[model samples]
Target: MIPIDLQILKYIFMEKPIYYFKMKPYFQTSEYHDLCMYITNRSDTQNSDRLDKRDYTVFDLETTGFLPEIGHEILSIGAVRMNGNSEKLDEMHQLIKPIRPVPNHILSLTNLSRDALNQAPSFLEGFQRFLTFSENSTLVAHPAHFDVRFLRAMVKRWKLPEYSPPCIDSQQMAKYALPDVSHRLDPLLHYFNIHSLERHHALNDANMTADLFSELLLIMKKEHNITTYSVLQQLLNRQKS
Candidate 1:
């Protein structure tokens, strides 16, 4: 029998200041570059001149807290499928049960009660479903680096071998799109004239981010002349250098 507790603990880490401090800078290292390149290149998405002609899977994760290495756990996952024109095709949202009781603060922040999560899918089950939700599309997320880390942690915790690329990050593109403004999701949504479905809800937030990403894609293509996923990755990689 798989010790679920031990598998859960694999996602949590002993708080190590050294690793935490140097994590962001690590993205600039050649080692990180090579790893990301290897995984992303293995994907079969075809290159296209029109940025809007490629489909993407925009997703989001709501966690118990910020630190993935500690006790922070993914509480829910929300995803939306977009067509070649960036139109929403379908969606999936799963509330996940954590191994422990959720704190009051998290409950208040996410408005997800213990009773609610208790009825939801377990971590392993929910995560496997999320992989299926992704299909063969490029994963899109706001501040993708943080979410992707938690995702990779999920695979690690479950002892599953999964290759994850640094997904197409809307925040990075936003920084390039609206360089002199706030890149926070809520404010950006307002800037783009997008109405918020709800705040702090994983599914709603994913929907909002998906809309925001579509808007940013237009900006990236027109302003920076980036028109495909390949170019977008190359462009961001250059910024990392």
Candidate 2:
């Protein structure tokens, strides 16, 4: 029979546990500690946290396919940090190795080959890096409902602590700002007079989405008087209802 100490050592070395996740006693290193705190401590009553005063992480994900529920996995993540509406701060782009084979259409759409992604980091590593880059910032995505759902699905699958940050859907915001205009990213790019980037590639999509979000913010401020985060969230909540 295996001794207790031997069993513990086997779990540590042979079983391959997530260092910070399950090994809390040996190493109490929670990588997501600050991110969780920031989101948790955010005051619902802070009405003065205006849109222009906040920092944002505008992000895009290129996945094998939609529907994370069916095992469609993320292939890449790209993001850019921005202060307020316009000032771009930093960027992060990382490829994630997926367990399943990449589909042909996805390859064409994202311009990512399996060979390229085989050399990339695993999903856990890539996600951790993304969280670090996005720490303490409100998250913005063109269609945040879809993007954020994928994020939540993956976080749950990985057994990581739940991360529910304040998220803004730029597409939804665009709908409110310009009721007559098409809300899709391509159309909005043309509408905003922003130069087009390579579509579907994660980083390029993120960069383009950042531009779209900035344009939407300016329009919202002028047309809707949505100058603060509270006002914007209220607008979004109202739209939902």
Candidate with maximal TM-score: 2
lDDT of 1 by residue, 1-241 (tens): 3365664565345323433443445446665454444444555354554567766788889897766655567999999989657789999999998765677888998988888899997665686577666756778888888788888875554334565653788888888789887988878988999987978888898899989988898788777887777788887777656
Off by over 4 Å in 2: 1-48
Give TM per candidate.
0.79, 0.81
Would you give me the overall lDDT of model 2? 0.80
How accurate locally is residue 168 in candidate 1, as Cα lDDT from 0 to 100?
82
For each candidate in the order shown, give its overall lDDT on alpha carbons: 0.74, 0.80
Clash pairs of candidate 2?
none
Tens digits of per-residue lDDT, candidate 2, 34-97, equal 4345435643232248888888999999997676755568999999999885999999999998
Q: What TM-score does candidate 2 reach? A: 0.81
